[model samples]
Target: MGSNSHPAALYQLRIVTRILALVILLLVLVGFLLPTEYRVERSVSINAPLDVVSENMLSGQNLSQWMHVQGGRVESFDGVLQNDDSIRLLYDESDEIGELTLLEHTGNIIRFDVRPKLSTGLVHNRITLEDHASVTEVKWTIEGDLSVGLLSPYLAFFANDIAGQNFEVSLLNLKQQIESQN
Candidate 1:
């Protein structure tokens, strides 16, 4: 009876492992079929003027106040690479962890290439400012491609929720800071 029970348990274990392997393979295949391109947008209305909001976006000063970072990774701007239209943040003073460059600035629309190097691909962010009756509406639209990788599409699939929530928190912080100043 003991011998028979041992063989049956081993057989069940093999069957369970085989089923787990098939499930993992299916998940990998599905990830490959998912889209690699992702876009995330978030907006907030600040009770400040258009110029005030635009200045805050363009200032490139005290970025740690409004820029969100999870996991306690702190990066400071490189003074040499910083200009009115561009800001580069680095680690250990030379290793670039993030960069934001003004791609274009039209009448009411401003575009910036925001690459934080936390992951693969270049992230493009567009900021649109509109003057409301008493408040200014600010919109941020970000887009990027995760490129070709087994897990990249899976990351892209969850990018909206992952990055969008971070952006939402950042926008809220910015709104509070801007509103308090006025």
Candidate 2:
């Protein structure tokens, strides 16, 4: 008889390939429906006053001393608490030049807009403080947009996993520095 079994195997292979292609297409479509925005918040309670916490978190020199920006060390931070000033950032690598501008400083809240030179979007950060006798709550939040480009929404979905660890480390460092100084 003719090799009908060979034709059957080829048919099965084509079906599998078509299934895989459809699955990939569906995944891409689902990604398009997702959001490209992300917000990450991390907090630590320090045995310090609100003023003390604000000083440490809002001061440029103090911030550069403790905060690690994208695993990069701060070269020089300018315009400490200078409202509406566009403070420039420089890392050891010249290409790491970025812009940080102070947006607001209200009663117990401070906001900033940060844009990395190599990035396509700006990150808006807010630090909120709540004071309780003998212990102060410091909440650090970062939100950003990556545009609606393919894979941007997926990238945002993992933003907390990626940026949260960095924020924890930075906050821990700040806590230690503040507590140690007191």
Candidate 3:
């Protein structure tokens, strides 16, 4: 090279830096512009007998005692368990009321589909039991997805963390409730 002035090189470097910064900004914008889908799954285990714990979950009336909600009331029932089954009810989370439906019911497993407040899709909850010697492991798992959009990824991440904690807390509360009954 001939003779590059100090100021000339400095100006060139500044221009290059500005272009690089613009490219990075564009990349970030594009990253957010891309569509994304999110799914969250959370579970917790409680120590109890499989039959007893599973029976408790199947009893729809007992849901209010352990679940995260403002309150829950049984609407109507037409099942063998009488008051144990609820036809309709609301699980209140702040101002959000989750409409729940009893999807499937078996001996040791109960599945409930929840339509969250104003969100799209339904969250499926499966409660099952596995015996461990004197104690049965009661496992409650929630699996669902959020609507896709720019905020979907962020919402998904937050929902995963919050929903996981919610299940953990519910399990802890359930453990206390069941144990206290003894």
What tens digits encode model 1's per-residue C-alpha lDDT throughout 1-182? 78999989999999999999999999999987888999998999999988777777544443556767553223444332223355554545444466666777765788778667545457888879999976999898999998756888988999999999988988898899899888
Q: lDDT of model 3 at residue 47?
A: 61
Give a tens-digit lDDT track for model 3, residues 1-182: 44668779999999999999999888668747644444454454556666767677545456655776435433333323332332444543344445666766677667777665545577777877677764767667777666665566566657667677767777787888777765
Q: Which number leads on TM-score?
A: 2
Give lDDT: candidate 2, residue 91.
64
My TM-score estimates for the predictions, one after another, are: 0.84, 0.85, 0.65
Global Cα RMSD, each model:
3.4, 2.6, 6.8
Kindly give the stretch of ten consecutive residues in candidate 1 with the minimal lDDT sum. 73-82
**Model 2 lowest lDDT segment of ten:** 71-80
Better of 1 and 2 by lDDT: 2
Error of 3 at 49 (Å): 1.2
Over 4 Å off, model 1:
62-64, 71-85, 91-96
Clashing pairs in 3: none
The digit string of per-residue lDDT tens for model 2 on 94-126 reads 566787778998768989888866465788999
Better of 1 and 3 by lDDT: 1
> Best-fitting candidate, measured by lDDT?
2
Q: How much does candidate 3 score in TM-score?
A: 0.65
